[model samples]
Target: MSDTPELPWPVPDERFRHWAGQFADMHHLVRDLVIPLGLPQAAESVLTTARELIRMSYFRYEFMMIGAGTSIIAIEAALADRYGKGNLAGYLKKAHADGHLTKEQYDLLDSFGRPIRNKYAHGDLTHVALTPPLAIGMLRTAITLLAELHATPSPGPSAGGN
Candidate 1:
């Protein structure tokens, strides 16, 4: 038997699977749509566009991570009002401190996700070698973290009217 521990929440495999199919379908649809517009007549242009689309789709995990991080920062900023304008690391730290993320989740983002994202964003391609499994794991973690943070109840006014 395997010794892996059971996960506390469901991993988002179905959504990712569906998204993968949709991404591929999008390429096909784009190709079909452009055929009537005389794009396919320029074989080089069609191939280039298709290849670029596939390459972009392959990095969907990175895009999702960046998007999720941005969303977390936005939510935190909205809650903290004037105090939210800062770097992603600072925002993530604040989220952890505010009980939005657990210690493990925070560490995962701090250690792996954030660094990879930074490297990718800064055009440090040599350091951004992401495998399929790693990308999937990171995507799952990001989704889980975002979902948990969004589900948490916001603090409200005190009952004593202070």
Candidate 2:
């Protein structure tokens, strides 16, 4: 048995696109809806947008890691690196904390959002396949997570400031 977790889904361009779009929609929601409502100052509005973009990009990293982790597992039954398939959540959490990912990365991941992409790519689901509900849930989670990331102020000039 491969030590790595089988991909929850596949890595096809379509599936990738589906995953990506879902997250993209989340960013779009933040930009079109959240920003307008938040009414953030111009200076901060851009940062807010950047924050959302970072969150969105992390999704792509997660998707890629899913593929990379699986591929790593394929190479060896056991994960040679501790940062293997099981550690994706941590990776995302850390990236969110560090603010390393760029808008481009998030855009790339959002591109992977497609229906049944994971099912066919990873061969995880049997007959069920990646359903609309599940994809929506994933998208929701992405949005929630991204929002959470932006909710807190970064440890910078304004972090816990007057």
Worst 10 residues of 2 by lDDT: 71-80
lDDT of 2 by residue, 1-162 (tens): 789887664223444454445554544433432322342254234334434433443344333333322222221211112124444334433443455334443332233332123443576433333333333333333333344444654344344778
Error of 2 at 81 (Å): 21
lDDT against the true structure, each candidate: 0.47, 0.36
Error of 1 at 35 (Å): 32
Best candidate per TM-score, number? 1
User: Counting only residues 3 or more apart in sequence or on different chains, how many pairs clash (N, Cα, C under 3 Å) in candidate 1?
Assistant: 0
Where does model 1 exceed 4 Å of error? Answer: 1-83, 153-162
What TM-score, computed on C-alpha atoms, does each candidate reach? 0.42, 0.25
> Which runs in model 2 stand beyond 4 Å of their true positions?
1-87, 92-128, 155-162
Supply the TM-score for candidate 2: 0.25
Instruction: Write one digit per residue (lDDT tens) for candidate 1, span 46-111.
Output: 333333433344335344444333333333333353233467677678778977667876776677
